[model samples]
Structure formats: C-alpha cells, structure tokens
Target chain A: MTFFEIMLLLFLIACAISIFFIKRLVNAVVVFMSYSAIMAVLWLSLESPDLAITEAAVGCGITTLLFILALKKVNALKEDGEADRDEHNI
Target chain B: MSIISEEGKKTLTSFSDWVSANSPDIPAEVVYPPKKDDHGHGHDDHGHDDHGDAHCDAHEEAHEEAHEELRSSAYEALHASDAPPAAPAAVTAQPKEKETVTEEGPMTERTFVRTLGAGYRLIAAVCGVLLAIILLVTVAFLPRFGSAENPALNEVSRRYLEEGLTDTGAVNTVAGMILDYRAFDTLGESIVLFTATVTVIFLLQQSRRKNDEARALEEEDLQQGVRSLPARVVIGIAFPFAMLYGIYVVLNGHLSPGGGFSGGTILGGTLILAHLAFGEQYTQRFATITRCTGILSVALLVYMGLKSYSVLTGANGMESMVPLGTPGSIFSAGLIFPLNICVGLVVACTMFTLYSLFTKWKA
Candidate 1:
C-alpha cells in the first residue's frame, strides 16, 4: 500500500510483538513508551494533533509516573519476601 | 542471540553445549511433533493423550503465571530502587497506618454509614461503567448512523456557526463559541484548574511548613535542593519562550483559533519546564505567581460574567466597543479576545500550581 500505511502497519506489528513477548515490567514500560510514540505518530497521520499531544503527554508522561509508582509498590512487596516466595509456590 | 556479537556468540555456544549434553542423540524432526493429529483414528487411543494434553496446557499456564509474577516482582524491585526516598516512606506508611475513621461512634451508626458508603460507591461504579459502554457502543455503531463522514462534526459546526458567530464576531465560529458565547463555561474550566492548584498548594504547604519548622528546631537541612546543570540551562532558555508564547496566545485570542486554554497551557508548560530543569526548589519561588493568578482569574471571571450578561438565560446583551471590522480580520472578534485571555491566564496558573504541589514533598 502507501508508505505511510506501511509504516503504521510496521509500528502496530512492533507494538503487538512487544506486548506479546516483553516480560520484564520495566522493559514492558519502555515498550509501552515506544508504543505511545508510535500511536502519536499514527494520530498525526490521521490529522489529530490535539489528540496526539494528549496521548503523548498523558499516556507517556503521567501514565508512566503512575506505572513507576505502581512498580515501586510491587517492589516493596518483593522486598517484603511475599511476591518472590509466592512465585515459587505458583 | 547470534554468533555475530561477542555476548551472543558466547550465549549460543553455551546453549548449544547444554542442549547437546541434555539430548545428544535427539534429531530436530523428532523433537518437533507433527503439525496435524496423527493419532485421531479412535477415541480410545487419543482419550488418555487428550487428557494429558489438557493437563499440560494447564501446567504451562501456571508456569507462565509464575514467570509473570517473578517479572512483576523484579520490575517492582527496579522501580523501588530508582524512586526518591519520600515515595517509599509514604507507601510503607500507608499499609502500616490504621485508618481510624469512625461513623459517629455507635455500632448501628457505623454499620449504616458503611452500608451507605458502599451503596454510593456501587452506584457511581455502575454509572461509570454504563457511560463507558454507551460511548463505546456509539463509537462502534457510528458508521451505521451516517455514510462518508461523521454527522456529529458537521452538526456541531453548523450549531456553532448559526447561534454563536454574530455574538463573538470571529470568522472561526467554533473558536468564538468556545471563548465568548460560552465564556462562563470557559471561566468555570479555568476556575476548576485554579481550584486544583490551590488544593495542591494547600495540601503540600502545611506538611512542608511543619517539616521546615521541625528541621529548624533540630538545626538541620533535611531536604537537599535540586541540581541539574543541563535542566537549568534548558529551563532558562525555554521558560522565556514559553511565557512569551503564552502571552501571545492570550493576547491574540480573537485574531486566531487559539485562546485562553491554549495560552494557559504554554504558561503551565513553562512551570513544568522550570521544575524539570532546576528541580523542586524553583517551584517555591513561583508560588506568588500561582497565588496571584489564581485570585485574579476568579475575580476577572466574576466581573466579566456580570458585565457581559444582563439576564444570563434567554438573551445575552453584552456590548463591545471594538467593531466587527471584517470577516477574517484579527480585530473583528468582539468579546472573544478578552474572554479567551482570561481563560488562558487562569488555566496556566492553576496547572503550574498543581504540578508544583505534586513534585514537592514534606522533608
């Protein structure tokens, strides 16, 4: 198809693959950041700069902070030995 | 990993050695089962295998879950390690601290309060879910409602053009409606932002002040100021431009599509930029700006509303001195300009103030 469409398709594929295979939470977050950037690009192509900006800022900025905060809480659980010990039992 | 890079080569060799050690005589064809079912001739023969397959699938799922749990914990570890000290302390304290909120002290009273709170929470959740579902379904079935384009877009544009254009006198009818015709709504939006900022400042200010007092009593600077040279330089350069652009957006509200909201964002962005550059210390210096803007915005909104609307409902008989000069001229939009400027200032100040509150912590 068109070059723009091809790029969009590739980005979607990359996002899907990352979502499927990325295991580490931090790595997954990094992938999500890339995914957000790609989505913003897709939005730009669709002629929605406002939506793109919102996605970039809120999705990548605030959401990332929240994710990091959540991960921090999870880490605290790990340090407490609950999450790590439960993994072996699972 | 491949044989190309040093690490890749080492990993490959190690893996290969391990594989060979585990199953030296295994063939690749033997390792991988056939694509199609080869033993599907009778139920008797395949029944046991099918049961085993089901069990294997279940086991695999559990294994995957375990791996996921491990990864999640690892991610948490990394995050906690990287986080600022205050965050861990807050998080740790949350679980340990018992919430002593009571319902007027009596058992019957407490039970009633609990039930009422639960009922309200349930109702709110249900309403939220219903709204989301309705929006989703509408979006999905939007194409069935019309042919080539979104009918809602055209309908909204038409409404803005018909009922709003003359009053605001802007060529871009949508902009005019957003700024002047619905100036009160814009004002409310600005006030909402201002309120958020004030709330943040109020919440953080007390705790921070208390901490400072404690530190003073103990004779120690428990809090360390921010220090990033690159951030300082970038903020120094960007802050002026952001402020200038913010003013421009507010000033040129009538001339352009952008108004108060857009301008305010630029102003807010400047604060964010400074916070990013100089760290949290710089935010304290700009508290005056935030407070002044918060008060000024609300006062301006109230004054504008009264001055512009004689009766508020059926007819808005606001008069403007500026002539609706031409269709596309910058000076044409009557009250849209001033209204937009007010909105921009309010939104900017509020956003920055809120962000400041979020970044700062009680030492």
Candidate 2:
C-alpha cells in the first residue's frame, strides 16, 4: 500500500478499535461515524468512487443519525460525573 | 386553474368523490370537518404555517375529523367508567398527545440482565485467539490481491474489459457492465432492498404514529442549545447543491464512476439531513410513509417490467429497436438511462422507508 493509504488504514483500524473500547455509548457512536468516514476515504484510495460515495452517505450519514436517534430513544446518557474525567485522552 | 374559486371547486369535488368512494359509510360532510382557521388539523396545536394548497387543506381536515372522533370517544369512555365525574376532569388534564418521553432516568449497570465472570472472559479470549489463528491459516491459501492470473478475474473480467464499450456504448465500463451486462444481479439486489422495506413495514405495522420520544429529544436538544443557527444555515445552503449533485451522478452514470445505487443513497442522505435539520414534521410532510411506498412500488414495477421485456426480447433473438446514441453522451445507453432512474427512485424510497420505520417502530 502507498504511504497515505497505509496511514488511512491505520487510522481506520484505530478508530474501529477505539469504538469497541469506549465506555460511553455516545462517544463510541461518534467514533464509529469517524471510522465510517475514514473507511469511505479508504474506498476512494482504492479507486472506487462509487463505493466511497455509498459508504460516506449510508454508513456515516444515515447510519450515524440512526444510531444517535436509537440512543436517544433508549436514553443512552452517561450519568453525571460517572464517566472518565481524564481530559488528556479522547 | 385560472381563479382560486374555480380551482378550489375542481379539487374539492374530486376530493369529495374520493372520500365517498373510499369510505361509503362515512358521509363526505362528516369526513371533511368544519372549515376552521388556517391551521386545519385539531392535533396541529403547534403553529404550523399552512401552505395554502387545497390538497393539504383537505388532508388536514381529514386528520382533524379523526382527531375529534378520537377525543369524543375518549370522553365517552371516561364518562362510562365507574370513577367519579371529577376523574374525567383529571383525564382531560393529561393529554396523551404530549406524553412523549417517559419518566425514566438513564440506564445503569444494574439494569443489565447478567454480567460475565472473569472465567468466562478468559475462555472467550482463548476461543477468539483460536478462531483468529484458523482464519489466518485459511487466508494463506487464498490468491494474492491484484494478481494477473487470479482465477476469479480470468474469463469474466477479460470479456467485460474487451467488449464492454462496443456492446454497451458507455465510457464507464463498470457502469456499462453493471447496468447492462450483469443487470440481473442488480435487479436481485434492488428487489432485496424492496423486500426488506416491505418486511420492516409488515413487522412494525401498528406502531404509534408519532415518533414521539425522538421528537422529544430534539425539542430538548433545541432547548439546550445543541442545535445551532449557523449549522442550520449551512445545511440550508448545502441542500440544493447536494440534491443537484445526486441527480447529476445518477444521470451521468454511464459516463462516470457512480451509478443508481450510490446516487440514490446520496439523495437519501439529503432526506436524512432534512430530518436532522428541519425535524421530523418537515421530513414527514415531504417523505411520508404512504408517499414513499407509492414511489417504491412504481419504481420497482418499472424496473421489473422493463428488464423482463429486455430479457424476453433478447431470448427471442429480437434486438431492441431504439438505437444506442453516441457513446460518452448523456443519452448513449438505451435502457440504462430509464433503468437507472427506476433504480435510483426505488433505492431512495427504500432508504427513507427503512429509516422512518426503524425510528418509529414501537415493537
């Protein structure tokens, strides 16, 4: 893979991993959206603009909104001051 | 069409006939409630600025009648109950229409049905490692990516590369191949989407109409300043451009990388954006479930009918009469142009329907 492609892949992997590990559901959903956006970029790097467009539109846009809406319905809210207070990490 | 009175009378008479034919029991007058103020629907307490279309007004009137009937029945039930007359007064105080969010707090760890022990975690890790090792070993037997002599890429890719241009009269080989060569596969996939939409509707048939909890959250979001004015303005600016670009991609499918699926999804994304920006009421006004189903039905019918005709004609060794226009131009592909539109419409409706159904599913 090219340098930029490798970097994007690494970033995507990191995002996916972090999404699994995140404690708060909202934070994990945000990470998942980022992962989808990066995955779209990866599709673009592979010279498939069609796949990229679909990934960006459906995965990141529609899906992220759906996730957030579902979360709101289930009240996926972290308790006040119960989550991690470490400001250094995302 | 000249004068408001004449046009209104025309639409009104047709509307009355439609109601009588649809519901012979309920008289037309009972169906259309008294012509109230501009805000026609009784449940429309929220000051929705009515766009002065006669069709819209008629829809509101229908809703208003239904709302009134529901209210009168509720009052009768309250009166019929054994409780005191004062209980009915209390009943009037609690409006179920506004009861969106339940009085419940956020989830806690204790709410989980069960928690895994350390021993189970250790066993899961071991099993995951074993599975990963087995998958890795299997991967080694697979052919390398982009190899010139890969088995999967031998016959089909060669033919697609060679005769795709002459056979399809399209510059973009992928589009030409998918839209013409392997059009059957596309049809199957589109049918799968339509089936999924129908399945969702069948499963979540009688959910409460209001996507109440989600709207409650949005109202809360607005109150807490979660939604900003600048973001709304930005989306307003982007909406038209996004719509134009989506149509452009679909129309130029034969000349570009994107086709019906991707372009349709992009269009669906715009509708989702509309929901996020303008709220469910606005989105529902335009992309109602009934309207989405109608559009989807028509699109699928066209796609299936057109493709079957082409396939049948091909099997009979009778070539289509329409001449394939000059390659690289907009009208180059004979059937692909209209077929792409059909696919785009089906996909767009499918996405919208899926989102709406999921968001509103009470089950």
Candidate 3:
C-alpha cells in the first residue's frame, strides 16, 4: 500500500479504538464522524465513486447528526456551566 | 465444582477473597446487628427460663440506653456544626439503618445474585474473545485483495459489465446494474427506508403527545435559529444551489456516478440545513409530516408497480414494451430514471422525518 493509504487505515483503527476509551460521549461521536469521513476517502481511492458518495453523505453526514441528536435527547450534551454545577452538587 | 482442579479451586477462592476485600466497606456491626441477640436466644433454649429472662431484660435496657445516647449526640452535632460533616454522617447512618433490616432478611438471596452477576460477566468475556478469534482466523484465510484468482471476479460481474449498457441503455453501468438489472433489491432498500420512517413516527408520536410545555420550549428555541445575521444570509444565498445540485445528481443517475441514495441524502441534508437556518415554522409550511408521508408512500407504490411490471414481463418470456432511448440522453433508460426519482424521494423523506422526530423527542 502507498503511504497515504497506510496512514488512512491507521487513523481509522486509532479512531475506532479511541472511541471506546474516550470518556465524553460527544468526543466519541466526533471521532466516529472522522472515521466515517476517512472511510469515504478510502472508498474513493478504491475507484468506487458511487460508494464514496453514499458513504460521505450517509455515514459522515446523516449518521453523525443522528448520533448528536440522540446524545442531546439523552441530556449527554450538557453546557460546561451546568456540568460544573452538577459536579459541585455531587 | 468437580470441573475445577485443586489449583483452580484455590485460585477461585483467593480471587473471591480479593474481590470481597476490594469491594466497598460496609461496617460489620451494621450487617450483623442481631447476631448477639440470636446467641442469647440459643443459650436460653438450652438453659433455665429465669436466667434467660434476666439476660434478655439486661440486653433490652442496654439497647435502649445506646439508642438514647445516639439520638442526643446527633442532635448536639446538628446544632453545633456547619452542616457539611452532619450531612455525610446522616447519609452514612440512613443507609446503614435500611441495610440492617433488608440485608438480614435476604442474606442468602443477595449472595446468590452476586455469584450470578460474576458468572454472567465471565461468560460474556469468554464468548466475546472466542468470537473475535474466530473472525480473525476467518480473515486470515480469505483471498488476497485485487488478485486475479479471487472468487468474486466471476461470471456474474462479467455479464453485468459486458452487456450492461446495450441491455439497460444507460452509460453508468453501476446505475444500470442496480436500478435496472437488480431492480428488486433497490425496491427492498427503498421499502426499508419507508418502514423506518413510519416506525420512528409511530414511536415518537406517543411521547410527543404528553410534552406540550417542552414542545413549546423547543418551538421557541427553533425560532432563534442561526443567531448571527451573516450566517443566516450565507445559508439563504447558498440553499437553492445546494438543492439544485442534489436534484441534478438524482436526475442524472443513468448518465453519471451519482444515484438515488447519495443524491437523496444530500437533498435531505439540504432540507435539514434550511430548517436550521429559517426555523421549523418556515420549513413546516412546505414539508409537513402528513404531506411528506403522502409523497413517500406514493413514490414507493409507483416504484413497486413499475418493478412488478418489468418482473412479470421478463418471467413470461415477453419483450418489454418500454423503449430504451438513446444511451447518453437525459430521457433514456426508461424505467431507471423514474425508479431513481422514486428511491430518491423515499430516502429524502425518511432522512427528514428521522431528523425532525429526533429533535421533537429531544424536547
């Protein structure tokens, strides 16, 4: 494989692993989004433009937005001030 | 137990001992408060009643005095302190009082549950590791990527490529292969999207009914979309062009790399952006839930009917009546173009509905 392809694959693996280790849900979602974006680029490099487009639009865009919405619904996306107050109360 | 050897038994016992040691400490006195009284009862059963009666009376008097001392000390602490230390003391005392009653009552059951939980975790870990090893071994045996000896480069792909354009009358072979050759698979995918949208609507609507105050709060939030004037202006200017590009991608599926799913997602994203910029009320006027559902179902029905006609004709050894126009023209590939539109509509509606439902439920 070329250097770029190897780097992309490494980044993908790192993102997947770090998602499990990341404590913050929002940060994990962002990592997952970057993973999808990288995979879309890999799809393009493999010469399947249709698959690349679908991956970019669905995986990177719609899925990430859906995850963020779900996070918001669960009240995981709290403001810093609110979180500090909660920690103080605890 | 017989499955474990002597060494395993020792290791298991030691592990259990470590777990118990590392677990949060609950005072022994709280856990076994009635043990002393139980010993007294046992002695009374073996000895004279007069001696047992005197011992029980002395025990009761000592318990009452201890309770009085505890209450007086707590009162004094509450009155004299700044309340932080007293708060922790109360928190600790409350749980101990509750645990003394409940723990004594269900001691056997609690141990059983603890053992069950440990067994579950061990089994889950073992199963997960076994599955991962199996997957890795399978991956190791798979044919090398892009190798001529690969099984995937077979007669099926050959047929799709060699006769694809002449057969389907579309320049984009992948589009022809998906929307024309494998039309039923595409139809199933569109149905899946439609079903998902309907399910989300059904699930969220019930919860949506009881939260009028939250809904009003969300409405107020939605009205305050893209607070910066410049951002709103930029979105306003770019919205139409982005929408046009999405439509172009869907319409030119037969002639280009773009197709129903990708283009439809772009369109759906554009709609979401519009909602974010101009507020829900503005978007609602054009794309209400009722109207979107109507459009979605109709598109799906049309796609089903067209595919059914094509399938029935091909099965009966009859020629298709629809003409395959010039390959590169916009109006070519008779059913493929219309099918792309139908699939695009289904996907766009599903994405839009999913986003709106999630936002509504968030409130």
Can you tell me the CAPRI class of model 3?
acceptable
DockQ (Cα-based) for each candidate: 0.07, 0.28, 0.31
Candidate 2 lDDT, A1-90, residue by residue in tens? 899988998998899778757777788888999998999898888888878888988788777877886865443442311122221122
By lDDT, the best candidate is: 3
Q: What C-alpha lDDT values do all the predictions have?
A: 0.52, 0.67, 0.70
- The model with the greater lDDT, 2 or 3, is 3
Candidate 2 segments exceeding 4 Å error? A77-90, B1-116, B209-227, B361-363
Candidate 1 CA-lDDT value: 0.52
Q: What is the lDDT of residue B56 in candidate 1?
A: 21
Supply the TM-score of chain A against the true chain A for every candidate structure.
0.75, 0.83, 0.85
Comparing 1 with 2 on DockQ, the higher-scoring candidate is 2
Q: CAPRI verdict on model 2?
A: acceptable
Q: Please, what are the lDDT tens digits per residue for candidate 1 over residues B1-363?
A: 232353332222222222222333433223222222322322222222232232222222222323322323332332232223223221233232221221122345546767887788789789978998999988887665334476665876677768665656786565676665665676566556666666766777775554332223212111222244576676688778867977876677666545566566666666666665665555556555457555556756653674355235326554444565665666667556556666666666665555545544333
Q: Tell me how many clashing residue pairs each candidate has.
A: 2, 0, 0
Calculate candidate 3's fnat: 0.65
Off by over 4 Å in 3: A79-90, B1-130, B226-234
What is the descending TM-score order?
3, 2, 1
Give each model a TM-score.
0.53, 0.68, 0.71
Kindly list the per-residue Cα lDDT of model 3 for residues B1-363, writing each as its tens digit: 443343333322222222222221322122122334544543443332332223222322233323422323322222122222223232233445653543353456546766887798789789978998999999999999899999999999988889998999999999999998889899888988988998989998887775353345345556556455687898899889988988998999999988898899989988887877887877898887778889999999999999999999889998888988999999998789999999889888888888877776632
